[model samples]
Target: MLVSKSAIAAVLALSCLVLVKPQVADAQAQRARGASAAAISYEEKKRQTSDIAVTIVTSGITCTCARFAEDIRDIVNDLRPDGLRVLPVLGVGGLQTLEDVLFLKGIDMGVVDEDNLRLLKKRDPALFANIEQRVHYITRLYNNEFHVVARKEFKTFEDLKGKKVSFNLKNSQTEVTADAIFGMLKIDVERLNYDNNEAMKKLREGEIAAMIVVSGAPQSALSRFRKEDGVHFLALDERSLPNHDLGAVFDNYLRARLTHEQYPALIPEGTSVPTVANRALLVAYNWPESSPRYQRLAKFVESFFDRIYQFHDGSRHPKWKEINLAADVPGWNRFKPAADWLARHKGALQSRDGRTLADLRPAFDQFVANYTASTGKKALSPRETEKLFIDFTKFLESQVTSQSTR
Candidate 1:
């Protein structure tokens, strides 16, 4: 064919595009299919199978929620209670876990922070009103420490004033907690939203002055930091600076400490960083007592409480040792089935044999009684009582360790 060089070049270019168009379209189509598959609702997936007895919506794979859920799944699998099956599904985090339990079908339970419920009530009263009645807690799980990590130069939380700080993803537990905490402190800062890994990167790169992480320690994200990284935890003190004059806001959190033992790389030996913590709750939708779902959940609750000892024997996440199935979670109502179960087995559940702080109550009361009877005076102060209880608990824990080794 007789053709000018320019015309030939143009023709070849058009031919190349024509050949590439189908490949690009095919790639896009494949991606669309994959996304659609991923987006399939949990209900639809559940309908495709008849085996799943209960599905728990937890946080990302790296979170404590995921590990706790997996442990429950394992326990259920081992016990094989009437062929019941447990499925743990990973979700966005605490906020999403709450949403999933409220709206998503096939989500029988969720792992959520107790403070999230309070936040919802404070931030969106209408929505909280609608869901609060619908949802109830199974039990209060372990505490998630509020980790405030900053460069060594920013020794105190006040030092990060007006600097960029990462609160992690919006609606995450970290973000919600940071909002409440920073609001209480009245310390203004440029708030940043990034995933855990990204926030850590920005903090290391000095793009952000500090990052708040609300998770079970040793947070894998913070664990990656080396001692030379110059990252240190900001202490949230009740008597001074960080938490001083916080008043009612302080009631939402418990005074907690992050020990060097848990994160030797980020913390110095024999020293601890004080911080606030929120308890994670195993919550469930309040299914009617007459429904099959309610019965299934009740059965699951029974099995879980019955075999909780297995979780405490170092077979699962260390946090399991801290779970107090009988502990009262302030401002939240227990699920009816769980409440009834606790009521029926009150003595056993409250006994020293269980892994709960309540186990020490009887001894504490006896000590108070004996002291008052002997001294012919008033009982010990609350502070003294707590100290004695703590000391007694430590001795009991040591005895448990000693016996287990034998």
Candidate 2:
């Protein structure tokens, strides 16, 4: 072939261009994959952070427990800077046992009832302390009265004495309150071992004269069963029960009404019966400040409180509005963070107390001033301000060393 020097040079250049194009393309693909892998790796590391992960274990699929679990799940799934993944696990047997196992297995947090949390701390202070700071009750869940459904043949709680009375579960809040109700009304019924399902079956079969149930309205085991069994929910005369304290375990118990509003069949509309309804405390183990989950969870909790009423109806119960951490249990260690945040953000938090997130607006304004003064910088954007506030709060939480219990 007749090839000139210029032609030869042109071919060499073309070949070089082709080789360079592929090298650039390969580098771009590698960078893209590296970026994707980095994002995936970050998320995986976040998931591996047991400190931020929350596992909610509950046996009952009642409105209160289920609703609370949904809230936690929403917080975890919500796309936020802090990584939080909530795992809701339904289990049988006991809360303490579940908590112990989760803690031993490196679970960061577990939501349980107040009584169970207390029992765990009482039984083993050291072991409880290890996870104590991590475990704090956020809110008091549904509280409804204890219903003693008996055959209409029995007129009063006393009239049902000496008969076989079935309780929901052993060592449960329901069972404990049942003991108090019977003792107070001077109703000496034999304590028969029967689960809620079993008790309902026995009630239908005439094996059990009366069955006691503790549950929220619109969806309670007893309320549901009473419709089928045609049983009467006997009203306890609150004045009758002696030693109303109920062995101190049920100190915060109230003379709740098994109302028709909640259970139309059991408590026909306007039919008010005296029963003790206790609140269920949604708890989680306290995590160290260094934990990633703690930071994300703290922010989620703040956001939850911000839109508190949007999700819950204030008409559910007067107590719903009065659910302030400082008010319900003034000395309660469970809601310390919530309480502190509420204090700092006074008007900003939603409550019947006329508080909202706006209360924190003043503090944030002050922060802007201080930040500007110290850094010689202009005010931060709203998003920047919020990020800074969250970081500061997390830093403060990290400084806290003691485990909380109340």
Predicted model with the maximum lDDT: 1
What is candidate 1's lDDT per residue for 1-406, written digit by digit as tens?
1113343234333433443457788999989978987887898766534443888998767788888999998876532224567789988886777988999998999999987777667667877786767889999889999999998899887888899999888788788889888988888999999888898888888889999888888777788889877788988885448445766556778889999888999878999998888899999998998887888788789767756656765567888878878888877888988888677555444334443545335544575566557657555565445445444444444444455479
TM-scores across all candidates? 0.72, 0.63
- Give lDDT per model, in order: 0.76, 0.56
**Model 2: lDDT of residue 142:** 57
Tens digits of per-residue lDDT for model 2 on 231-333?
A: 8777654354443434442464665666677667766676666766656655555666566656655755666555454344433433344345434533236
In angstroms, give how far residue 109 of model 1 lies from its true place: 0.9
Worst 10 residues of 1 by lDDT: 1-10
Q: Number of clashing residue pairs in every model?
A: 0, 18
Off by over 4 Å in 2: 1-52, 74-76, 79-83, 92-134, 183-186, 226-228, 239-252, 313-322, 350-406
Over 4 Å off, model 1:
1-51, 78-82, 238-244, 350-406
Q: What value does the lDDT take at residue 374 in candidate 2?
A: 69
